[model samples]
Target chain A: MLTIATGNKAVAAAVKEVRPEVIAAYPITPQTEIVEQIAEYVTSGELDSRYIPVESEHSAMAACIGASITGARTFTATSSHGLAYMHEMVNWAAGARLPIVMANVNRALGPGWNVWAEHTDSFQERDTGWLQVYVSTVQEAYDTALMAFRIAEHKDVLLPVMVNLDGFVLSHSMQSLETVTPGDFVPPLHLPHAIDVTNPAGYGTLTGPDEHFKFRWEIEQAMRKSVRVIADTERDFAERFGRQYGVAEEYRYEDADVVVIAMGTLGKEAEVAVDLLRNEGVKAGSLRVRWLRPFPELDLSGRDIVVIDRDYSFGFGGVLAHSLMAKSRIEPYSVIAGLGGQEVTFDDIAGFVRDRTPGSETWFGVKGNV
Target chain B: MTEIPKEEYILKCTSACAGCPSSLILRYVLKAAGPDTVLVVPACCTSVIQGIYPNTALNVPVYNVAFAAAAACASGMSEAFRKAGKKTSVIVYAGDGGTVDIGIQALSGAFERETDFLYICYDNEAYGNTGMQRSGSTPVGARTTTTPGGKTHAKKDIDAIVAAHNPSYLATACAAYPQDLFKKVGKALSLRGSKFIHVLAPCPPGWRFSSEMTVEMGKLAVKSGIWILYERESGKVTINGPSKAAMIKPVPLEDYLSGQGRFKGISQKAIDALKSQAEQRAKHLQKEAEGIC
Candidate 1:
């Protein structure tokens, strides 16, 4: 069905189509709409799912782990502080190799207390054995959430997946969404180690030093192999749903002199900036990184790169810029913009490309270049 | 005293300490819950006692979880089982620390939701898995490793806390009385909607007593009315065999406290306080049972 919906509602719609058997929900700002929508669906009999309104985010993830381990498809949604609170169980869901899907509304971590768009929250969980995908549009959020189940439940890639959307920007912004009846797109999860009620088995037992690292290595091995699974799932999804997605969404990069790289909503805005620079006769293009973990292979050998980061790593340079520099062996000018919902227009983005110093990082709107 | 099934769920060998009452409590717990059950355990002695990875010393399936997550996990598992159209019993077997300390919020959450599961807390009075550290459940005047000078705080009333949830069924048991423990488990499982069983698990080594005296120590606790045995069902309280008898003519409090080295250097003031508290609690229960104020 084709209709207009907010990014959060799109995610809830996709979840209803996928029909996860269990959903652990705890409310947090920007992410509350997703759970509320899901709760409404469950209450109205539109969707048949066991919705657990858990007390805290820790219990939310824990409940998902419990249900998922029993071979039931599961999901949950949360924003910044809730994500931080469930950090332990987040690692657990992946370590246990349960294919639980989650939607994370990207928001800033606080002291000044902001509930706006930032990538720091998701980036903080970079090493937790979870596949992360950032979506720019409502359609993309809906589509990615649907595909998350297929990718995570693939036999060779039994890991949890996090679908991230920019807080208040993509999360609350309304856009077109076309829902699908996922009949066989996401097959039933068959966890090899799932508990059988009839047969008595033991789980979460103490692991001696000899076997603990082996289990960790198995997780890494499965993660390394998920790259292929993700491609196959996305390819199959396009064939069935008529919407194409990739590890990185690219725009006009073939004949460009400089390629601007970014993620989330910043990626979409960077495309407008690229068009503005092109109108001004600057050979510019855009590549929005979609997958953060198992960051895909992009051959950026022959292009001058300008990277926009909505997140930072404190003492280190921009995450995307520094990672791209290491991966492609090229120094890209890094521009930090749109943090804590700081405004940055296409005209300003165009100027960033016009006056690009090869290895310099400019924090846009910071006075005196500090 | 129990015509309970002869089948044993716990295997003969595991890494649990000798005369560990928590394991005894679990053995009865599993037997009553049966094979078609999932035991949600936390970071307790039972977690270590379940044997290492790739090998299980249990007949029924166990889902080991983080310290504070046993009840929360059971909440999810019970709902999942209910949704799947399977009649699988979800039980949480945790230590007192997991129940009264770190796990209280999850327990409250699960019970408040009226989840269909049995929450079993084996109260050994201290964090036995972590070298006998003083936990919230540790009684006042007990000397644990962290309470070398003797604990100054009273034991946490975990039973009262769980009862506040208005559980479908609630009971107190001891490893010294296996029949009572087994019967309580069976009774709790017979009915639904968030049941709780708090068993007084006396640890021999932690209390500085001989392993052989474990059962005797539990018996003494009830004889002196230090640990009451009772059941609360449908908002009514009933004092069980040992506790009912102890209330009429109880043994001296010093008999319960003297044998254990943990209470060796305990002050007279602390003992008087413990005795007075026990007396007040028994009187309240007795009055409630007799329909008095």
Candidate 2:
């Protein structure tokens, strides 16, 4: 069925279809509507799930961990500060290897207190052992959320997953989404270490030096195994719903001489830039990385890549540019743009591709030259 | 004495110190909670006492969580159990540092939501696991490693703070009195909504006392009015233990403070102040009890 919904509502709709046993979340801007809609679904009897209005984001994640380790499908949503607060438990969920799914609205962290779209929030948690997938549209938000459970809970890949969407850009913007029926795409949750009274099991135990390294290695092994699980889950979803998603989606890349690489809604904007560049007869295309972790293998060997990053690593460089460089030895012309929800239209992106030099970074629209 | 139950859910081997009162309190509570209980323990002494991974002292399932997250974790566990169609008792066992200081927000949230679980705070006075540091539950004039001279302020009224949330069952228990603590745990298990029990677990090393004097220190605490025993059920408060023996004058504060090296050479002025504070609190409890049914 076709319906008009914001990215937040799309996530809620997908979660409803998955039918998680427990939903725990605290309201944070851009992420608030997702929980509000879930609450509505619970109250309206559309979804039979326990909704815990947790006091803080830390508790929200803690509660999710509580439910998740009990063989229950659990979910929660949060924005920048909420995500920061949930930092400790966010790491806990992944380290414990619970297949919990969370829809994180990508917002910039505060000191200046801006609640705008930025990748820095989720990017900071890059090493927390969570499989992070950034979505570009309302439809992808709905689709990726549904597939997250299957990917995370796959026997070989029992790790937490975070589906990140651009805070205000995708979270609040209305777009048409094709809703799928509740299918067997995601199987019933079965946590091998679930708390059972008949056969009790202890979780998140204290590990000493002798055994701690082995536990850490196991998480890494599961994370590596998720690449295959993610591919398989997406394939199954595509077969069932006739819509496909990949770890990285390439658009007009085959014949293009230059390609723009990005994640989230910036990728969608870059696609538009590709079209404009093509009309000008410039061989330009876009490679949108959907999954940040299980760091997808990309063939950026032949093409000159222009990496547009909505987030920066302070003293270092753009996250996407750094990843691409680390993977394929591609010297990406990293352009820092749209930070804290600063406007980066197709024209600005096209101009970046047209005027950029190879190697190093360029701070788009900033007065200072990099 | 109702013949304290012999059922034990804790294992014989524990990583706790020789005189750790928390282990005894946990053993007794677990005995009452039975086999169908899941403990959500935060960063406290119990976190270590439960032992390292692959070797837990607990026979029942335990979810060792981060500090300041026991109540929230238990809240989730309770809801999960309810969803799973299991009637298991979800319990949270935290220390003074985790409970009164760091974990209070989560505790208050759980209470407000009326989450069905038994929240226990094993008050060992200071952060005993971290080696005698000052915490919100550290009493007045008691010297911890952090408070070299002596703690300047009185202990935070955690029981009264929890009571403000109006839990289904609320009680203050002492490890020195095992039967009373066990009975309270059993009673709390019988109730439905949010329940909280504050257990004064005296730490020998932290209190600067000999390992053998753990029980004696706990008894003296109650006798000196430093640790009062009481229960709050549906807004009613009932004083228990030595505090209830109002007719016989309470034991002097020095009786509790004198022997412990932590309180060694404590001035008479500080003792008087602590005594006055305890008296005022006891009097307030009495007035509050009179107003209740």
Runs with alpha carbons beyond 4 Å of true place in candidate 1: none
**Tens-digit lDDT string for candidate 2 (B171-265):** 99999988899899999999999999999998888887899999998988888787789998989888985668732577777888888888887
TM-score of chain B of 2: 0.96
Each prediction's fraction of true contacts recovered: 0.71, 0.72
Task: Kindly report which residue stretches of model 2 are placed more than 4 angstroms away from their true locations once superposed.
Answer: none
Predictions in order: chain A TM-score: 0.98, 0.98
For model 2 chain A, give the 10-residue run with minimal summed lDDT.
A196-205
The residue pairs in collision within model 1 are A201-B61
lDDT of 2 at A49: 98
* TM-score of candidate 1 to 2 decimals: 0.98
DockQ of 1: 0.77
Candidate 1 per-residue lDDT, tens place, B95-192, comes to 99999999999999999999999999999999999999999999899999999999999998888888888999999999999889989999999997
